[model samples]
Target chain A: MVRLLRFLVEPLVLPRWWQDALLLLPRLVCGYLLAFEFGAVKFGLPWSPPDHSLGLFEVAFWFPGDVASYGGLFAVLPGFFAWMGAFSEAVGGLLLALGLGTRVSAFLIICTMLVAIFMQQIQQGMWNTLPAAGFLWAALPGLVLGSGRFGLDYILAKPRRHEHV
Target chain B: MNTSRLSLWLSLGFLLPACVQPAHNKTVVYLLDVRGIPNVQQVGLRGRDNPLSWDQDLPLTPVGNDSSLYRTVVTTRTGYLVTEVKFTVNGEFELQQADNRRIAFGAPGDTVVYRARFNVAGSLKP
Candidate 1:
C-alpha cells in the first residue's frame, strides 16, 4: 500500500531540473488550454462564429441549473458558484500558469477540481474526469512546491533570498 | 488506445464550455407499459436530478420487438442520485416516477460506460 502511494506521488522525486520542467511545462499547457482555449468559449470574449456556439461572461443557463440540481449549498446560490467555477477555470488558469499567487491559484484550482470530481466527473465516469483529475493532480504539486524554481513565484522570491546576503 | 482516448477527451473539453451542462452517465431507460399508448412517435425524459431543468429533453428511441420498450440512455454526473424522471410519450401523455433511474458507472475510470438499467413502468397516462 505504501509502495502504491509512492508510485502515485513518485513524480515529485525527480531532480531539481526535472521537477522544475515538469512543474512549469504542464502548468503552461493545462493552464493555457483551460483559460484561453478550452474555457474561453464559455467564460471569455463571447465568440461564436457563424457555425459555432460560444458566449462571453456568461455561464451557460444549464450550468447553474445543474449545480442547483446537485442540491445542498450548491442549490442556494448556484449562479455565484457557477461564476466562480468558470472564472477559476479561465482567469485562475491563467494565474496558475504564470505562477502568480502560485499556492493560492492552485488552491482555487483544487476547489474547482473537487467540484469537477464529486459534482461532475463522478457522474460522467472516469473518462470524463481525466481533465479534471489531471488538473487536480497537477495543482496539488503546485500547491505544495510553490510552482518550482522556474516559476514567477521563484523569480519574485529570489530577490528576497539575496537580500540577506 | 490511451492516446486516442486522450484526444477524444481533449476535444470534448473544447466543446464543454459552450455546452455547460452537468456531466451525466449514460442510462438506458426500458420504459415498460408503453404499448397501450397511441401513436408513440417519440419519448423524452426529464427529472429532478436534472434539477427539473435542462433545455433538451433526452429522447428515448424504441427498442426490442413490438416497441414495448422505449430505450434511451441518459447521462448525469452522480452515480446513486435518484433521478425522478417523467416520460412524455407520443408528445402528449406524461408518465412520471420511474425505477432504476439512478445513472451510475461500474467504476471510476469508466464514466462513459454506464451499467445502470432503468426499467420504468408507464404506470398509467395522466
Candidate 2:
C-alpha cells in the first residue's frame, strides 16, 4: 500500500515555481471571468454614486468615505470599505492571473470577499450574497493550493550548486 | 502562460482608474413595499463622507397606483425631484415580487439586494 501510494503521488511533487504556475491558471481564468461578468453590467463606475438597481445593501461595500449622507460614525465608513474592496478584487484578481503577486493578491481577494459576506449576512436577503458566497467558496481552496506548476516563481527557483570537496 | 498572466494584470491596473470615477454624490433608488402598497423612493447624492448623513430621503414621486416606480434627483446640498436625476421602473416581476428590487449605490461593484416586502412589477415605460 505504501509503495502504491508513493508511486502515485511522488511524481506530482513539483518545484515551488511550477507549483505557482499551476496555481495561477485557474485563479487567472476565474478572476477574469468574475471581473468581466461584473464589469459588463452598467452598475456604476468605481468612483461615483451607485444606481437604484443596486440596493444600499448591494453597494454597501463601495460607499465612499468622504461622502456620507449623515455625518455620524459610519460617515466615511462605507466608502472607505468599498474603496479597499474594489481595488482588491480588481487588482487582486489581475495579480492572481499574472501570478506575480499571488499571495498578496489572494489575501486581498479573500479580505474583500470576507467583507462582502459580512455585508450580505448583516443585510440579509440580497441578490449580491450569491456572488460573494460563490467567490469565497472557490477562493479559499485556491489560496491553499497557491500558484504552482508553471509560474514565474518557478523560474526563480533556487539553483542547485555542487558542494566543494 | 505565466508571462501572459503577468501582462494581463499589468494592463488591467492601467485601465482601472479610467473605468471608475467618483460620483458627484450617491444615487440610490428603492422599490420599497411599505405594507402591501408599493413605493418607489430615490435618494439623491449619498454625500461624500458620511453614510448616516447620506441617508437623506428624497420625495417619493408616485409613478403608478402600484407606486413601484417613481422618479427624483438627489445631491448632498440640494435635490431636485424632476430635473437632474430621473427615475422609472426598469421592469416588475410577479415571481420576483417576493424578491426585493435590486440597485447599486456609492461605488460600482457587484452588489444587489432583493428587499423582502418590496417587489418590482410592471415596466418603466408605462
Candidate 3:
C-alpha cells in the first residue's frame, strides 16, 4: 500500500518546466474534448447541439434504464444511478478540463471510464475500448498527480504546497 | 481533500450496483418508451428482429393509464440482439436512442421481464 502511494505521487525526475509541459498537453486536450464535445451532447450546455433536447442537469436516461434491463439489483433506482454516471462524465469532464477541483474531477472521470471500459467496451471490441482506455490512463495519473503547474490547480494551490501535485 | 475523498468513496458505494448486468437466460420482455410525445400517429420497434434491415417495424402496445409506456415480449434463438424503437409520432418517422438501445433475450428457454425507455421532446431528426 505504501509503495502504491509512493508511485502515485512520485515526483518526476525531469526539470520542472519539462514536466509541466508534458502533463499540460494531455490535460488540455482530453479535458477540452470531454467537456466541450461529448459531455455537451449528453448533459447539455450553451454549445450543446440544438437538435436534441437533453438539457443541462438532465441525463440520457435510456442508458441507465438500459443498465436496469439487466434485471437484478441494477433494476432498483436505475435512473438515479444513471444520472450520477452522466453527471460525472459531463460535469466532471468539464471540471477536469478547467483543472478545477482537479483531484475530485479526476476521481469522477476514473470511475466513469472504469465502467465504460469494464462494462461496455470489453464486450464490444478493442477499438471501442481504446479511446476510453486512453482517457482512463490520462486520468489515472491526474487522480494522484492532480493538475500540474500549467493548470488552474497550480495557481489556486498555496505556497510551499507543491507536494499536493 | 479529505471530505472530497470521502464523498468520492460514497459515490462509488452507491454506483456499485449498476455494474452487475450479467447475461440472463430467459424469455425477456423489453418495454420501450413512447411517453410525452407532443403529437403521434403510430409507433413500432425496429432492428435485427423480423428483418435484418430496419425496413420493417414491430408495433408497441400501451399499458393502462400511461399512454407513454409501450411493451413487447420475445423469445430467443440467437444470443444477444440489439434493437431500437421507431415512432411515427407526427407523420415523420423518429427512431429512439438514435437506435443505440439493445436487449439480451437471455439464454434460450428462460423467462424474465426487462424495461427500456426513450423520449423525444419535440421534432424528429431529418
Candidate 4:
C-alpha cells in the first residue's frame, strides 16, 4: 500500500526552481478554465452557474446525448463516458490545479482532450480544435513530469523523520 | 496515513456517491420544426423552469440528417405540471405577438412532445 501511494504522489524534480514555476503558470490557467468554464457548463459542480440548475455531480441532460453522437463505443455506454469526461474536467482539473494526483488527473484530461479534438472538433475545422489542443498540450507536461516542486504532491511526498528513506 | 491524507480520502468517498442522479418522474421532449426558416444555423429553447432558465439558451440537437428539425429531452422531478417555453433561431427568440408557448406535462413516466415551428404563432402541435 505504501509503495502504491508513493507511485501516485511522486512528482518529477526539476533542475531549477524557475523552470518548475514556469510550468506552473499554464497548469494553473488551463486547470482553472477546465474546472470552472468548460466542465461546469456540462457537468455539475459546486461553482456551476445558477442558471444551469445542476445539482452536485449531476451531469447536464444534453451531455450524454452529445457523447453518444460520437458513435461506436461512446454510443454503447454514453452515460458512463459522459460522466467520466465531465468528472475529469471538473474534479480532475481541480486536482490538477491543486497538484494533487497530478499524473492521474493529467491522464484523464488527456483522454478527454483527445476525444474532443479528434472525434468532435476535427470536422468543425482548426479553429474549433484549438481549445482542446491547448488543453492537451498543457496536460502533457503534468502526465510526464507530474506536479514538480510547486505542488501538493511534492509536499505530501516529503520524507517524514519517523520513516527511514 | 497522516491527517491530510485521511481527510482527502474521506472527502472523495463522500463525493463519489453524489454522482447518482435523482429520480425523475417527468420527461419532456421538445421538438422544433424550423423548415420555414432559411439558413438556420442554431436552434435553442428558453423556458421558465429548473434546467431551463429564461436567461440561458439550451441548445437543441438536429434530428438525424434533417437540418429542419431539432430536438431536446428534459427530465424533471415530479409535480412540474406546466411550463412556458420559447424557441429561438440563431439566438433570436420567436417574435410572436402572442404569449410564450405553454407546455402542460402529463402523468409521471409519460413523455410529452411539444412541437412547434420557428417564429410561427399558434403553430404548436401538442
Candidate 5:
C-alpha cells in the first residue's frame, strides 16, 4: 500500500511542460465530447431531453416568481443564454482541441457549464454535478499551465517572429 | 474572423426557433414566471386510455392547496390546450383549492382553481 501511494505521489521525471501536455490532451477531449453532447441533447437534428434531465418547461416553473421574472428580461434572455451556452461549448471545445487560448475559452465554458448545471440539472444529482465540476477542474490546469505543445502560446514564446527555417 | 462570423450566424439560428410559434396548435402557454419549477404540463387528451404519456413529461407547477389537486385539459382541434391549471402545494405558499366536482369551466360563485404552486403576490389582471 505504501509503495503504491509513493508511486502515485512520485514527481514525474519528464519535463514540466510534457507533464502539462499529458494532462491537457485528455481534458481537451472531455471538453470536446461534453460540448458535442450538449449540442446533441439541446439542438441536434432531433432534439432530445438530456439523459436524466427535466424539460425546460419544468425547470422554469420551479423557481420563485421574482427570480424567474428577471423583470421582463425572461422573455429573451433564456434563449440568448442558451445560444451563448451552446456556442461557447461548441467553440470552446474546438479551441481546446488545438490548445489555442485554452485558458480563456475554458473559463468561459466553465461559466456556461455552471449555468447549465444550476438552472437545468440541479435535480440531476451527482452524475450531472460532477461533469460541470470537471469542466472547472480541467480549466484550472490550463490556466496554471497555459497551452502545451504546438499551441499558439508555445509558438509565440519564440524570441523572434521569423524563427522557422 | 471566419469563426466569429460562423458563431454569429449560429446565434441567429438559435433565436429563430423561439421567435416563431411551433405548428402544434393549441400552445401550452406558461403563465407564471418561475425558473427551475415549470407550472404547465401539456398532456394530450386523445383516446380513452392513458391520454397522458408521462414520457412527454412537461413539468407541472404544484399548487399549495391543503388537499391534493390536479388539472388536465384536452387540446382543441387547433392543437391549443384549453388549459385548466391546478394549484395544490402545501406550506407557506398554500392556496385555497377550487371544487373538483366538475371538469368544465367554473361559473360565477363556483370555485376557481389556480393551476400551480404560488406565492401571495402578483395578482392576475383577468
Candidate 6:
C-alpha cells in the first residue's frame, strides 16, 4: 500500500529548477481563476458572490439545467454531473494550486474542459472555446508530470529515513 | 494518492449531500425577448424580491440555441402577489420606460411564468 501510494504521489523532477518554476506560473494563474472566479460564479463556495445566496457546496440553481441542455448522457443525470463538474473546478482547482494529487485533479479538469469546449462552446465559435482550451492546455502537463518538482506531491513522495536502508 | 489528499476527497464527498437544497414552494420564471436588443449587450433583471435586489443585476441565461431569448428562475419560500421589476441591458436599467414591469404570482406550489420584451412597456403576456 505504501509503495502504491508513493507511486501515485511522486512527481517528475526536471533537470533544472527553473523549468519547474516556469510550469508553476500557469498552474497558479489557472487554478486561482478557476477556483475564485469561474467556478465560484456557478458553484457554491465560501467566496461566491453575496447576491447569489449560495450555501457551501450548493450547486447554483441554474447550473443543473444548463448541464441538461448539453443533451444525451448529460441530460440523463444533470444534477450529478453538474455537481461533479463544479467540484472539479472549485475543489480540483484548489488541489491543483496546492500541488496535491496533481494528476487526479488534472484528469478531472481535463474532462470538464473537453465538455465545455466541445459540447457547450463549439457551436458558438472557436473564440468561445478559448477559455476552456486554455485550462485544458494548462492541466495537460500536470497530468503527465504530476506537478513537477515545485509541488507538494514531490515533498510527500520523498523517500523517508526508514526507506533509505 | 497520499493520505492527506485521500482524506480531503473523503471530506468533500461527505459534503456532497449539501449540494441539493430543499425545493421552494413558489417559483417565478422570467423570460425576456431580446430580438430587438443588440446581441453584444447582456440582458438581466433588477427587481424587488428575495433573490433580486434593486441595486444588483441578476443575469439571465440564454434559451437553447436562441440568441434572442433569455430566461431566469427565482424560487422563494414565500409568494408575492405583485413584484416590481425592470429589465437591464449591460447593467443599465431600462429607464426609457415610464413604469417598472410588474409580475403577479399564483398560489403556493404554483409556478408563475412572466414574459416580456426588452425596453417595451405593457408587453407582458397574460
The numbered model that scores best in TM-score is: 6
**Per-model B-chain TM-score:** 0.46, 0.25, 0.52, 0.72, 0.23, 0.71
Question: How close is chain A of candidate 5 to the true chain A, as a TM-score?
Answer: 0.60
Per-residue lDDT of A52-136 in model 4, one digit per residue for the tens? 5578888766677678899998886677778889999998889999899999999999999999999999999989999999999
- Higher-lDDT candidate of 2 and 3: 3
TM-score of 4: 0.62
Quote model 5's TM-score. Answer: 0.42
TM, every model: 0.48, 0.41, 0.52, 0.62, 0.42, 0.63
What is candidate 1's lDDT per residue for A33-79, written digit by digit as tens?
Answer: 77776556445444422112234555544466666777887786676
Q: What is every candidate's alpha-carbon RMSD to the true fold?
A: 16.7, 13.5, 12.6, 10.1, 16.0, 10.5
**Can you write out model 6's per-residue Cα lDDT over B52-112, one digit (the tens) per residue?**
8888889998897756878999886532255678988888788554777876666767888
lDDT score, residue A161, model 2?
70
Model 5 lDDT tens row, B9-113: 777656633532122223222233232334433222212112223223333432344323333433322111122333223211223343211122233233333
Give the worst 10-residue stretch by lDDT in candidate 1 chain B: B111-120
- Measured against the true chain A, the candidates' chain A TM-scores are 0.76, 0.55, 0.79, 0.96, 0.60, 0.95
**lDDT (10s digit) by residue, model 1, range B92-124:** 435234342433243323433222223334232
How is the predicted docking of candidate 2 categorized under the CAPRI scheme? incorrect
Candidate 6 local accuracy as lDDT? 0.81
Per-residue lDDT tens digits for candidate 3, residues B7-125, read: 98667657643442233233556565666665645556555533323665556667756567766665433323333334444334564435434443434566656555444433222
| Pairs in clash, predicted candidate 3 | B25-B107, B26-B110, B27-B110
Clash count, one per candidate: 11, 60, 3, 0, 22, 0
The weakest ten consecutive residues by lDDT in model 5 chain B span B42-51
The whole-model lDDT of each prediction reads: 0.59, 0.43, 0.59, 0.83, 0.44, 0.81
Give the TM-score (vs. native) of candidate 3: 0.52
Across A78-116, the per-residue lDDT of candidate 5 in tens digits comes to 555544555566666666656666666667777776765
lDDT, model 1, position A125: 78
- Give the TM-score of candidate 1 (chain A): 0.76
For candidate 1, the docking band is incorrect
